[model samples]
Target chain A: MTETRGEPDVEAWAESGGRERAAWIGWVTFAARLGLAGVLFWAGWTKFTEPVVLQRQAVDAYQILPEALVGPVGVGLPVLEMVLALLLVVGFATRLTAVISGVLMALFIAGIASAWARGLAIDCGCFGGGGPVAEGETKYLQEIVRDVGFLALAVWITVFAPGRLAVDRKLGL
Target chain B: MGKASRERSARERIAEQRKLEARRDKQVKTLAVAGGALALIAVAVGVVVMADAGKDEPAYTGPLAPTSRQDDGSVVMAKEGVTAPVLEVYEDFQCPACKGLEESSGNTIKQLAAEGKVKVVYRPFRLFGQDPLKGNSERAANAALCAPGDNWIKFHDRLFAEQPKEGKVGFENADLISWAADYGVSGAAFESCVNNGEKGAQVQAMTDHAFNTAGVQSTPTIVLNGKNVTDQAWSGDDLAKAVQEAS
Candidate 1:
């Protein structure tokens, strides 16, 4: 394709240190994607190791979803998390995976916010094994902050489209 | 020579463009397939787990069981002539606080039941500890359900008596069987019942009932006439007063 008059010139930009800047963004994106993947994998693995019933009960404690949906949501969530983590790690379908990750995080944030608002003393169940928290042990603020941080990473990956060492690069994504 | 070479170069550029387009199409196709497969696998896992949800073990048909089982899977103990209001006690054996409740007021409550002053209904609420499936709370609840009500109560007391610290594997399967024998619930049939964990499903159901139906969250939840009197823990006099007030 021919560059328009006002369009940035790749050759000229490279001569003006744009190469180092692009590499810098690529490396940062790579690190953020890897970090998010690691977090999701660890969280999913913890929940996976526990019984599916435990997960169900944890969701039941939330009392947010209808009883029928609880079973499917509880069981599917950790598996989905692990799958998304795997794709992110391998850099396959990075943008799509990031969108899913963002959606999940947003749902979680809403769940936590409601629980906090309602004065329900329950664990967020982010990693695994959550239920009613004992009196004076709720950590809603910290959990929300952490999830928001992860959501930020998800948004960044989705928008910036990290390329270095990614399957997306090879696939012309 | 120059004209022929230029013409060949132009043809090569067109071929290269076709290759790039083909590669892009193939990559999109692969990604779509991979994404779809991953989603299908996730849905399959969820369905399989949900299918496994209601898999109850064979119902308990052993001896010394409850005379009347509640609809929510809890066992009821009603003295022959007791006409007093029912005192529903929700407890988990692995809970130290539950043990504290039992140690301080277990005898008082049993005496009340013995005297027919109050019909104490013991419900196994297995909310204590981390592991939902293999936790001591579930194991002890399962063992208790296998035994008859009278023997179960005896075993229940002994369980609290030998309650291990939280976050520890105190109720080994073999040890549970042996303890049942000590509580006068012995023999091969009883041992097999405990070992096989036939009432595993019932225990799980009871746990769910405690949470979903009864709305009881923690252990040692004393309900007098369906009103939670957990504030009256560790004090027999206070619990008795509350029960009296309720009646």
Candidate 2:
């Protein structure tokens, strides 16, 4: 599969297909990262705007964890989410960013699941306040299921594709 | 040596290598920039959307100080110790927000009740009356009423804690029995009361009183010191201030 003159080896290149495959994967990575970043950014923004609601959620979570850690975790989660969203969107250390997003989604799923299991009728507060959990309605299971799907997509991008057309690669980092 | 031919070959090779390197670099840079830009846009959009969504939510402007009936069929208001304030709460057991109010403010109200500063009255309304088999408001009210002595508060809290959200499906007879066991109440007594529709009339009367007499329109319509506190922003601090003023 040798090419004439300086042209790349078409047949060998076709067999390896590293560049072409990367390009295709890049598009997938781009779309997934964008979608997930949007979701995280929105969630973090909600927490930031309504600190009280976030505090309530944190306190509810506190019931499941050590009291000492609740305040710090509550305050840190939104900020951390913002940073992760930025990282994912900007293509800064893409694989690392995707992993962080995946982990956060997993944690969110766990939190909702635990709250449901404990029979706590509180809002998930993934997006800030609406109303408390109404009798006979458990939104947690659905929420967890959604997060699982997002996590799967994130993991796929993290492992197989470089964040398509990101600044990190542009900066040669 | 064929100096001319060798020179041309060397130049060509160098030029080809440089072009290949440049192409690779350009592709990499383009990919990186595009990815980064997309992420940033997503984050920005997310932030705006989330903020808007938060704003669209309705603020909780319902009752501040909630009151409930004790097992002895006596009205227990938190203002007894807090002041001469009268607190009335119209609640539905199946309502999730009512449950939140119960969990969050139950202790504070209990303290006020013990102090005998506030007069609290609880009116139970059946919001989920549409569901006959699953709605637990009537049963919960009956169970609390049938509880022995001062076990009403304990039972009330337990009901809120165990109550499921709408659509999640609540406990059946067996589950309720287990929950009663946790509260040290005899399952048989609780079950009998629930099954026999005990306190059903009382619950109905109270709900009717709230709507017709008290002009209550919501599950948690609180009256502070005889003045209706419904539709007012009732935070913990606000409640304390109202108590101080009434005192």
| Number of clashes recorded per candidate | 2, 40
Measured on C-alpha atoms, candidate 2 has an lDDT of 0.62
Looking at model 2 chain B, which ten-residue stretch has the lowest summed lDDT? Answer: B55-64
What TM-score does chain B of candidate 1 reach? Answer: 0.67
- Residue range B1-247, candidate 1, lDDT tens digits: 6999999999999999999999989788767856774675467566756675654222222333233456655666656766468888888887655765675567667655655567778887678545532377777887887776654676777888787642346787788988888868777877777888878888888778888888987776888887887767456666777766766
In terms of lDDT, which candidate is strongest?
Answer: 1
Q: List model 2 lDDT by residue over A1-173, tens digit each.
A: 56373323432443367887757766777888888888888877777665343344444531565745554455456656777777777777676677777887888788788777776655677765534444466577777888898898788667643556776667764
Kindly report which residue stretches of model 1 are placed more than 4 angstroms away from their true locations once superposed.
A1-17, B1-27, B30-44, B47-51, B54-56, B61-247
State how far residue A42 of model 2 sits from its true place (Å): 2.6
User: Model 2 compared with the native: what TM-score?
Assistant: 0.51
Listed in order, the DockQ scores are 0.06, 0.07
Mark the regions of model 2 whose C-alpha exceeds 4 Å error after superposition. A1-35, A45-83, A89-91, A103-171, B1-74, B78-84, B94-99, B113-117, B130-133, B146-151, B161-195, B208-247
Error of 2 at B191 (Å): 8.9
